[model samples]
Target: MTTPNSFLVISALGKDRPGIVNALSKKILDDGCNIADSRMTVLGGEFAILLLVEGQWNTLAKLENALPELEQELDLTIITKRTEERTPSSNLLPYAVDVVAMDHPGIVNHLAEFFSQRSINIEDMMTSSYAAPHTGTPMFAVHMNVGIPSDLHIAGLRDEFMDYCDGLNLDAVLEPVKG
Candidate 1:
């Protein structure tokens, strides 16, 4: 009997600057690996990158070996982990929500706390902020896709979220995720 090989997920974090992507992608290309999916962003002046890479199990050592030099050059922390095969979902219903408010601290933290309490899983999230040109005040926004269990009541959840939003001075809208 033989065990099956698996894909790998790579995540890197460090201060935001130029050439981070170039350095990492060069290493991947030199190792003959392919990037299946990736997301890179600058969050609060720190650069974060998440990548799903596919290659042969025998080549894993090569990929691991290439990281140290890049880490030294970019002053970054790199982590690579094997990915588990995803089981098919039967009762998964997708939900999406948008949140917008005056820029303030603890917004994401508060929303995440609420979601965790309800066992809601966030599949994807994008957050951004900008200054209003006229007033020079900041506006914040978040758009996220979440998974809702079949047992939860949507109306009750909405009401609960509304109360929280009122307290935070934020506006939230929840809707079904459509393809």
Candidate 2:
């Protein structure tokens, strides 16, 4: 029988440069591991990458063993952890939340508090700050994928969330995430 596939999460950080992705992906491929999911971006002067890799147990182990050498060669800080495939919850419905407002501290913390108090789970989120057009005023934007419990009252939740956003002077939208 074929060996069962195992999963590994790899995160790397380094000074921003070209060819990092090429080198890393090449190493993964050469070690017989496949990248299942990845997020790569530059923040400030740093390059950051997060990858979920899949392979047979031995193959993953081989990649793990080679990581230290690769880290030195690429001048990156590498971290790895073993994981299992995620089993999504059936009682949750996916929704999207968007917010844009004047750049300020506490926006994310407040949003998290709101969701946390409601027992909602935030699956993925991204936030950015930029200058608004014409005015060059600092502005912040957030996009989040959340899993709301199916039993929650949608209309009530929407009304409450809108009111909450209004109280915070945030422009926001809440809607189901289209598949």
Candidate 3:
């Protein structure tokens, strides 16, 4: 019988520069670990990375143990945690949420509170701020993947969500995330 692969979640933050991905990927490869999934981006002046890695237990242990040296070599603050593959819940329906508005504070917090109050889970979210074209007005946008309870009333939820967005003066969409 074969043992199941172990999982590790790694988050790294450091000064933005070229070759960070290359170096990080190379290290994972050399350590006999596979990048199962990752999100990498430059946030302000820092490069942020999140990686889900899979490997044999010993291999993952080696990789985890080497993190200190990797941090020093790459000049990153690296954090690692062992994790297991998620067993998705069948009682949840995947939904995508998009919102755009004039840039202001508390938009994310407000949205989070709304979902939390309804027992909905925000699986993933990405937000950005930019200058609007022509007018150069400051604008903010958010995209989120949420898990809505399957037993919930979709029409009611949509109506309520739209009304909430309208009250906030946010242009928003709530729809299924089609695979």
TM-score of each: 0.83, 0.97, 0.98
User: Per-residue lDDT for 5 in model 3?
Assistant: 97
lDDT string for model 3 (2-37, tens) is 999999999999999998899999999999999999
Q: Please give me the total number of clashing residue pairs in predicted model 2.
A: 0
lDDT tens digits, residue span 39-114, model 2? 9989999999999999999999999999999999999999999999888899999999999999999999999999
Best by TM-score: 3
RMSD of 2: 0.9
Clashes of 3: 0
The reply for model 3, stretches above 4 Å from the true place, is none
lDDT of 3 at 70: 92
| lDDT for 9 (candidate 3) | 98
Give lDDT per model, in order. 0.86, 0.96, 0.96
